[model samples]
Target chain A: NAGVTQTPKFRILKIGQSMTLQCTQDMNHNYMYWYRQDPGMGLKLIYYSVGAGITDKGEVPNGYNVSRSTTEDFPLRLELAAPSQTSVYFCASSSQGGQSPLHFGNGTRLTVT
Target chain B: GQQVMQIPQYQHVQEGEDFTTYCNSSTTLSNIQWYKQRPGGHPVFLIQLVKSGEVKKQKRLTFQFGEAKKNSSLHITATQTTDVGTYFCAGDVTGNQFYFGTGTSLTVIP
Candidate 1:
């Protein structure tokens, strides 16, 4: 079973460009999250969804947006890429309410120039 | 917003030596989890502590939660090269968001 799948393992974007980071989980988890990890830093929450049609802002959700239209998908969108936004992005899912262990995707290495 | 912080931002130890990382939360936590991330890899869940003053062990690794439920620690009995990675602590405050600590990078010298 594919726990969590993230598309565009690596991507490079010019400043002001926009892109979407796709995330899907086959585990039928109810909770999904988007996080970014900078060099030598911990994961910073960006956006999260508890269930379909429900989403919320996380600790670091300024430059990004998220939508959960279906139970299996939660995608993160970067409206305008900036150098500071260049980092490794990860998608994660949990079966229970943030109380369960999180299953994370391989991650997407994004670079903005 | 609840904050979780880790100490010893970076550590280097010789093989066979013990290592530990501490996690402290700005407020009381409902629970806390530990994760390990290898170089250029995603974070993987290690263990979770829910009860105050709880302790759990995974072979060579030991995890503990403070009595106040606001702090935790992970201790590795004997470090190995395979243990080289960054350890992070995530705390659940409101049961909705789990704030992650800054993380402690550990390097083992063989």
Candidate 2:
């Protein structure tokens, strides 16, 4: 089974543009997280969902929004993207919250010019 | 928010040399996990530690958790070329989320 799937493996957007990064997991995990990794840096949490219809802001939530409308899907939206938003976005899912191993998607490489 | 930091942001070691990376957290952690990311790849789970002062080993790699549960370490004995990657430690401050360390980039010199 595809553990986690992310759409738009690569994208280029101009400043002030908006786009959505789609994430879906087949494992029926209760926890899903959105993270971004800058060059030569660690992953920063953007947003997270404990389950369907529940969402929370993370450490670096500015300029981003997330919705968990379905158990299998959690999408991150970039509003008025800036150059600083150019980074690799990863969507991860875990069977449990902060206790189980995380299954991460390949990641979306976004470049904002 | 809890913060996790890793030392020696970058390390270069000769093949077969030992290497270690340390992780420290600003607050006590409920659990800590280690992950490795190869160049141009996503991070992959390595292991997790829940008990204070617990140690686990996987072949040449050994992981340790601090007694206070605020720090952790990963040591590789006779590191191989395959060990070249970025190592990250994620500390769970609460039951809901984890704060990831800055990461240590290891380069193996042949």
Candidate 3:
């Protein structure tokens, strides 16, 4: 089974472009997270959802928004992309709480110029 | 804020040599998780430690969580070229968010 799937493997955006990064999971997990990793740096959490219809901001959620419409889909939206937003974004899902291991997607590489 | 800090941001070791990366946190953690990311690849789950003084092994790799539950380490015995990757430690202080450590990038020279 495809544990986690993220769409638009790669994208290039202008200074003020808006886009959405799609993420879905087939594992029926209740916990999903969106994280971004800059060059040579540790990942920073952007947003996380504990279950459907419940979303919260993480450490770096300034330019991003997320919505958990269904248990299988959690999409991250970039309202106004900036150059600083260029990084590799990963979507992960865990079957339970933090005690469980996360299943990560292949990641979406976004380059904002 | 940076809650967790990892030592030796980058490591270059010859094949067959031993390699170690450390993760230290000022606050107590309920559990710790380890992940490895190859160059140009996403991070992949490796192992997890739950007990205060837990230790787990995988073939040539060993993972240990400190007795205080604030520190953890990943050691690779007889490193190989296939082990070249960036290792990360994520600590769970609460059940909500997962914060990552500084991260250690390992480069094996074969």
Candidate 4:
């Protein structure tokens, strides 16, 4: 059913460049999140949205921004990319805030030179 | 800030052997969820535990939640090659974010 979809499976950016990571879900979930995973490390939360027109900062929101303009879309934006920002980014959605299982997208691998 | 930690970063077990991974949270959690990520794949939900001192089993796998709601564990009996993956424990605190543990990478050898 295409639970969650992330665009641009892979991308490369030079320092100071900007790009957007697109995420969309078809399950009509209320909670969406953005996370980054470094090699051999756990997923770190970047930004999250409880519902349309509502967003909040997560554990690791630096150098990233997010917007939830509709129920089906939550996009992450990277401005002035840095080497430290190079990592695999994942998008997830859940039916509720807690106690619900999350549906995740395949993820986008980004490299910043 | 809440944090979840997992032990035994890597584990290798022969087929038919048992495997276990532990997770601890620095703060009390409202609920704990387990996920498995296969090689080159996104995390997939496995189970969720909410009650204190709760124990649940799914076929060959067993899951337990600490009495204080700050720790959890997952044990697998008679492991197989299909069990190879990185297991992660994610805790939900204050009803908002899901903080994930470092994860335990398990390998089942034939």
Cα RMSD, each candidate: 0.7, 0.6, 0.9, 0.6
Q: On a 0 to 1 TM-score scale, where does candidate 4 land against the true structure?
A: 0.99
Error of 1 at A109 (Å): 0.7
lDDT of 3 at A78: 99
lDDT of 4 by residue, B1-110 (tens): 78899998999999999999999999999999999999899999999999999999999999999999999999999999999999999999968679999999999999
Candidate 3 colliding pairs: none
Order candidates by DockQ, high to low: 4, 3, 1, 2
* Candidate 1 Cα misplacement greater than 4 A, ranges: none
Residue-level lDDT of model 2, residues A72-109, one tens digit each, is 99999999999999999999999888998888999999
lDDT (C-alpha) at residue A12 in model 1:
99
Ranking by lDDT: 4, 2, 1, 3
* Candidates 2 and 4, the one with greater DockQ: 4
What C-alpha lDDT, on a 0 to 100 scale, does residue B72 get in candidate 3? 98
Candidate 2 DockQ category?
A: high
Give the residue spans of candidate 2 off by over 4 A: none
Off by over 4 Å in 3: none
Q: Write the per-residue lDDT of candidate 1 for residues A27-102, one digit (tens) a residue.
A: 9999999999999888899999999999999989999999999999999999989999999999999988668999
Best-fitting candidate, scored by lDDT: 4
